[model samples]
Target: MRRSKTILLSLSAAVFITGCSIKPEPLLPKDIKSSVKKDLQLLSNIVKPITKAITLEEAIDRAVNNNIRNRVQKMESALAYKQIDMVYYDMLPSLAANAGYSVRDNYAASASTSFTNGQPDQISGTPSYSVSQDKERTTTDVSFNWNILDFGLSYVRAKQQSDKYLMAKENEKKVTQNIIQEVRRTYYQTVSADALLKRIVPMKDEVKDALVQSRKVKLQRVSSPMEALSYQRELLEVLRSLQSLERNLMNAKLELSELMGLKPGTKFELSEKVRKNYDLPEIKMALEDMEKVALENRPEVLESRYKERISSKETTTAILKMLPGINLNAGINYNDSDYLLNNDWASYGASVSWNLINIFKGNTYNKIAKTQIELAKEQKLAVSMAVLSQVHLSIVNFKQAKKEYELSKEYLDVAEEIFNLTEVGNDLNMNSRLVFIKEKLNYILSTLRHSSSYANVQNSYGRIFASLGTYSDMKKEEVKAKKVEKKLVKKIMPAVEKKEMKSPTFKTYGIATSNLNVRAEASLDSEVKYVLEKNKKVEILKTISIKNDVWSKIEDGYVSSTFLEIQTTEVK
Candidate 1:
């Protein structure tokens, strides 16, 4: 029975522990649904979609205007400024006004015994006086108090808050620079992916057609089973490779959409038309100049300096706490009572108070302040070191990326020339079908590599700019001149009108409410060809039910019906 009771107790304890355990907030299907709903509402209001090619400048502006992360940083900076205001109020004199009612249970009396005779042993007379005090009374008072020591402490606190407010601005600048860097990187990736996809998409269709013809030819011939199977396998492998590349291209587009704060799967074209022999920015400044620029302008370095100032002011505040306090107070009071004292009075007073124990603890306070100052200085030094290292590394990486991109271009050009030669030979019946396929694959692969390298070059430049804590038009020659003239406005840009494409005839159109897949079939496990961004327009041919979920068929593919907002239904 004892054993059974112990088991029961253990079970009870387990239950209690489980009940008290903390759970992470609801971050699953419900949160996802909520976010989809919000995106749908936001996109529905956007009448124009990006149909024309988007310039890098335009893309960056859109991201800065729409990104929630930048807005969050701006709000944080505003909160810091409000904190400075609150600290400033602390330096003002404290004023208080109060009124009260009091009741007494009895009258008050006083008596005095006096010896009128010059003899020490004799008491001449005894006199007494009595006065009836009111049973109830009302009193009111207004007072003002000012402590010089506290005011000095508050001044230091306000100064620290001001420095912290500057720190917030620096932090905002840092976040903005990072955002712009991301825009540059993702923009290049999107353009590269799009370029590669356009080239491979037609190639994929041609290869699929060729695969069908080859299988037909194999079946018509009385060839060895091994030979036929090998031919079929080769074609399937080619198809598989192309499919994988297509998927990667689709994913790259989705990522770009996300970075721009657009609905996932949104389709937009980039302005960079040529894939090869593209002109990119050149790094003109030397390493010394880069180091100097980074040290002076990098947000992290500036923020560290501000933090050191704030810490020094905080140390002053801590020392002030250990000092003696001197205060002045003034008040006027009014009372209504049936007593012989004055009913109204005005008074003023001054005081000086010190904690005697604090005198003995002065050394400890001084040590703490000293330690904090040293810590702040060390932190500042560490940040400076990190910034300098980042500048040097970024420059090296940029140069390396440029070299790699140039090499990739050479490889792509050679592949293109070889593919062209193979195509001509195949047309003249001098080259076998297998040789043509292999050359085509090589060309496609080289194209993809070239695109990736191009993106890397852009990303490297983005990193360089980020390390320097600035963003500017890379195509422009004189960045330093523009930086000096431009105001440091971290404000959001105004929304611009995006060009919209017209719909095809008799097509039922809908907007995607979430990032959704365009699948080969109306099934959950169907192969996904494209990912439609939220707010992207799709032509819906019909709707079909796949188990519990409804799906809409478009010209090229099918998508989930739950997140599709049919335009005609809404219009009606």
Candidate 2:
């Protein structure tokens, strides 16, 4: 029985030690690198080879959620919220506990004796100096302090913090606006690249066919050798153009993927097709009204306004520095010479303090503060001017892009008609091969130009909306406005749903280890389960149940799964 108890105790100890010794999993280099490389390659393939079938709104949503810079700004904004909360309670009283112990080798006690009228006066006993002695002291104190008043200085400081918080909020808005513009621009570029590729590939095939025909005709003595050579040169040129377009397409894909914060080399197929027609909204408002809107809605303008308020508060704080600071303090202290029950002392007193003589020495700081106020005013003006200038530029570009899109559409139609006529003439032997080729080239150029012009106009519209600080508002308004007009435009488009592949699942295991190198036999299974592949990327997600921690009583937020692709095998 004693032996069995000993064995049981040993086993229990071993289990406890193993359970407590468990460490987090270390990073696996080979696996991580391989996974990252695979993810990047997959991204590259998608963007470079796949057709895009994602909408602009979807792209923007992805960018906002995934873009690194945008995410950083979002985090900063969140941190600022906490800081705002902290500053809001700055006026509250603070309490602190302190304890200390000290040992001294030398201690002295002294008293002075005074003689009145040539006679020595003594009370209780004669005053005498004591020999050095060791002393030990220990003290514990609880203190509380509150700033009752500071001539509006605390108020000014709080206001400054509030303004800073507001500025941070506006900065977040600015980042969001910038992100929307970037996503829209990149989406347009991707579409343009796709359109150009479509045109160039067909043109290349046509040129190649023409070259082959020319070679056959020359060999049969139906055409001159020089003509055949010219056709071959044209084919080579067309091939070079195709190569350039392919390179451009690849670059556009890479840029779009980067903007969307996909792993480098990720593939994307644009879901939105290029549309040629855009109904330009009439600008009925005067420039002043536009400026007013910008001032009212622009995040940068709001930031600048907040900065001005911050500057005003800073100036007030600096001026307050010139005033003398006064503080009232009173505290009770207890002292005892012996550790036991004798020689105890207690005292309490109030004290006042003032620093009145530094005024002459620190006038320079006050002067600098005044100068800063002026500088801040100038900066505010500069920001306002820049905002107005940008708004003007955006308006001008919007008009220009619209006009170019219109012209390109008309030119494309004309070019298409001419090319058709030339093809028919060639069929009847009434047109030369060179004329036919030139007409074909003209059609290709027209199509490319029209596509590019349309993209440019769309991007310009996005910019204008961004500059007007109306992108988000416009997005909301568009949804509302389209509902009433849905019947009229119902035939213009059809809704398409995207299909996604099923994600893979993996099981997690918990292992116990007593030492770093040796595993223990005792292990407990955890009931927690987490989805690892939510985003289709290789990021790990760990979830713990509320019952596992001290804050188990409080409801925790839902843990989403994160997915990472490990490898891709080519299927035969």
Candidate 3:
């Protein structure tokens, strides 16, 4: 009893000490400053170095390849895929090995007494005492348990996981499309800035000179006070507009830098020549066809379909839970004891257990599961409707952008002609130099407008494709995780065969572990088409997950996934 009290007191003291150690502590200012400095330095190092001028195509590539948000989505899709592998383990039978060692200060002793009728015969009873086990001993056991109900549940869960992985891939596609759109918009704006920066700088000096002359004219009364004040007002208005444009032009480069995942204030040059149509073949499709395409390819629509599958599986899982369970258990156990006839033995047994009370709740649970499935279907339809709306809206925006581009082009031509005539001294109200400066500024404004309007037109055109989900086929024909093994993973899931993944399905880096054979299909029995050299880099196009094995369709052909490592992103 004394020893027990001492042990309890020791445990209480230890618990108090641990509790004290866990008190909340705030970071010091110096520590936070050091962390910030370290992270900024690391951020500067990871960005790929730029060479020469960056074109629109290169800008898109940089954003897709290095944008932190884009990379995160790729990693997320990969994580979801890996989870499918983990859930498969849960479906397997429970195999466990246990080992134990025990010691005591005294032996475990039991006494047996002789009895008469239903009670001990105190007058003639004899009692015996025995110690059957050693004071110190070791025990070990290995067990295997399989439950039919649990297996069914795990199978359903795996199906859900497969759908989830596909959904994540679809989301990644949506994010890539967004990145491309953003890069295109920023690239054009930056090109406009680069083209106008030099011209705008010299014009500022002319405007300042004109403003000073107008102020002097007003003070000396060389002209009417009203007319001189009006001239100064014109000069001031032009300067304000020019300054605003300059500020906007200056920030365009910064926005592009951040989008491409480069450090802030990183200086880089852009190609002055804008990619008018971005090298993409003209998008020509009827509204009806576009709607059809959007419905077929939009990530939101696909994600909804995947969600519906998850819900249907949930219904099946619920049913499995309500049914009876049959468990089969087998184990082998051993004991180290001096007084035992058999120190090792095996056990086998089967059990059927049903909660009769669950029958009362079965109908309600089934209804709830079915209702959830209906909800998922409704959500899918809603997403499909939204996708169609975006398609129509993108078309309208494209038309408006086209008209604006034409109008800006006309304005630029007229402004340039007027500036030329004034520079030759055609009556610019007698002050041809100042008037020429004003005309020069107008021409510059028109040029800037032309660039901005054209950029909008390109963005709107891309939006049409983006809304249709065809932007998935981007530069290099590879937007991050280009939809993955949809053509195959779909057949492997969906409770049936469905949608196919269109090319190019993404290419990620992987290495062959051996002289791996590339098969015609995701099976061993399929004909082996080619062999890969060990340790060679393989361009993985599609990844398929089958029962216990994984296969990747690479440039050569389908190879065992176990030998290939998929790197979602790499820092160089």
**lDDT score for residue 150 of model 1:** 87
Q: After superposition, how far is residue 229 of candidate 2 from its true place, in Å?
A: 4.1
Candidate 1 per-residue lDDT over residues 1-572, each given as its tens digit? 57767988999999999988968786799889999999898864433467788877777777776677887899999999999999998999999999999755555665545555764443336655656567687989999999999899888888888898999999998887878778877777777677667667676776787777666666787566577677668777988998898887777667666656776666678875434555666777788888888888888889888877776675677677778999999999988875747888999999999998887777787787778788888988999999999988988898899899889889976775555444322321112566777777887788678878877877887788788776653435323322221333221100001011122222356799899999998888899998999899977666555445667778889888778776532222
lDDT of 2 at 113: 73
What are the TM-scores, per candidate, against the unseen true structure?
Answer: 0.68, 0.64, 0.74
Evaluation by lDDT, superior candidate among 2 and 3? 3
Task: Return the lDDT, model 2, position 424.
Answer: 27
Question: What are the per-residue Cα lDDT tens digits for candidate 2 across 375-447?
Answer: 7778878888888888899889989988998899899767755554443223212125557666666666676
lDDT of 3 by residue, 1-572 (tens): 57867988999999999988996789999999999999998888877898878877778878988899999999999999999999998899999999999977678987866698999755425556689999899999999999988899898898899999999999999999999899888887888887777667667776787788778778888889888877778788888888988998998888899889999988888864532222222445688988998999999999999999899887787677789999999999999899989999999999999987777777877888899999999999999989999999998998888888878777765664454334322222425445766777777777778879878877787788899898745353333312223233211111101112222222356687778888989899999998888898876665555655667767767888777644532223
Work out how many backbone clashes candidate 2 has: 25
* Model 1 segments more than 4 A misplaced: 1-52, 100-138, 217-221, 265-267, 338-341, 427-431, 472-572
TM-score order, best first, reads 3, 1, 2
The CA lDDT of each predicted structure is 0.73, 0.60, 0.77
Lowest-lDDT window of 10 residues in candidate 1?
491-500
Which candidate would rank higher by lDDT, 1 or 2? 1
